[model samples]
Target: MSDPILRLSGVFTDIAQYHILQGVDFEVPRGQVTMLLGRNGVGKTTTLRTIMGHWRARAGQIVLDGQDIAGLPTPAISRMGVGYVPENMGIFSDLTIEENMILAASSGPIDRARLDWLFSVFPPLQTFWKGQAGNLSGGQKQMLSIARAMVEERRLYLIDEPTKGLAPAIVSTMAGALRQLKDQGASILLVEQNFSVARALGDSAVVMDDGRVVWAGAMAELANDASLQERLMGLSMEAGH
Candidate 1:
């Protein structure tokens, strides 16, 4: 197999006096989805932020492809083919949908073909092209966020909780969008709370606890064994999806 597109080795990030990410280590394989799972406050978001340089790595190396990007600025990391969709969606509420997308294009102008493809995946974007992003529903905003990331051709993407607080129907739609992204051979590192989404999209998974990975394996192995899911995630299949 080819080397991982992104590798985090003993990554440590500090926020103020608190040490948020303590020695996080994982690999995002090329052309595969790697799920990052854990309870709240387990540094999952911090890991993604660290990779995007939102939070600087106080220690450890963040290797992208064959280059170390540990301390590079967020823009620098983004220019190197890594895209990040933050938890907040990060869309400018005041901007129109078209304006938001135009700003997201880091590589010259947005490709007309790619824009058309995105419209196919998310038709609402076209419908609301002139409307302010803040006027969009939560699900539409989520789609816009992911779409903005896709606007540029990126090698790897770090997405934080795309399904959080979404209705079941919206979740299903987001799932389909993610499946299309995967089918197109995009590499993704996702931090999701929904096990169903994780299992459906992940090729491999790493579970973090208190800023460290406690479990790492195939998503199928974790999905098939309810006992393992309970032991690691502290939730039964019946409790929630």
Candidate 2:
């Protein structure tokens, strides 16, 4: 396998004197989806924030495409081909959808083909191109957030809980869009609480426990091991919850 597009080695993040991430280590391979899964308060979101430089790491290295990015500012880290979609879906509520996209467009020529592809994948975005982002539903806002990230053609995306708080139909839509992005050769590091969504999109799974990777392997192995799910994810595969 090729070297990872993003790598976190022995990463430790501290908020004042309190430590959030302790020796977190993981890798996101190119053109693949790596799902980070764990229960709430297990440092999943913090890991993403740390990677994006929102939460600075006090120890270890954050390498993007083999270059250290640990000390870089958030904007500089983003410019190094890491796009982030936080759990809040960070849409510019007051701006029109088109305006939001325009703002996110990097300092390069707009990729019309990519824009058209995104529109095709997210049809609602096309219909609401002129609508204010605040007016869109939860799922539409998530689509816009992902679209905003795609506008700059980043090499890797850190998406936090893309399916959270969405209708089942909308979750399906978002899943389809992610699949399309993967097909188009984008590497993704996804944080998801929903096992079904993770199982569907993830090529590999990293199970976090108390800010550390406790398990890492193919998603299929995770799907087949009910005991592991019960122990690591606090989930039971008993037909229907």
- TM-scores, all candidates, are 0.97, 0.95
CA lDDT of every candidate:
0.91, 0.87
Task: Estimate candidate 1's alpha-carbon lDDT, on a 0 to 1 scale.
Answer: 0.91
User: TM-score for model 1?
Assistant: 0.97
Could you tell me how far off, in angstroms, the CA of residue 119 lies in candidate 1 after the best superposition? 1.1
| Per-residue lDDT of candidate 2, residues 144-198 (tens digit) | 9988988877889999999888888988888998898888788999998767888
- Of the candidates shown, which would achieve the greatest TM-score relative to the real structure? 1
- Superposed model 1: Cα runs more than 4 Å off: 237-240
RMSD of 2: 1.5
lDDT of 2: 0.87
Q: Candidate 2 clashing pairs?
A: none
Query: What would the TM-score be for candidate 2 when compared with the true structure?
Result: 0.95
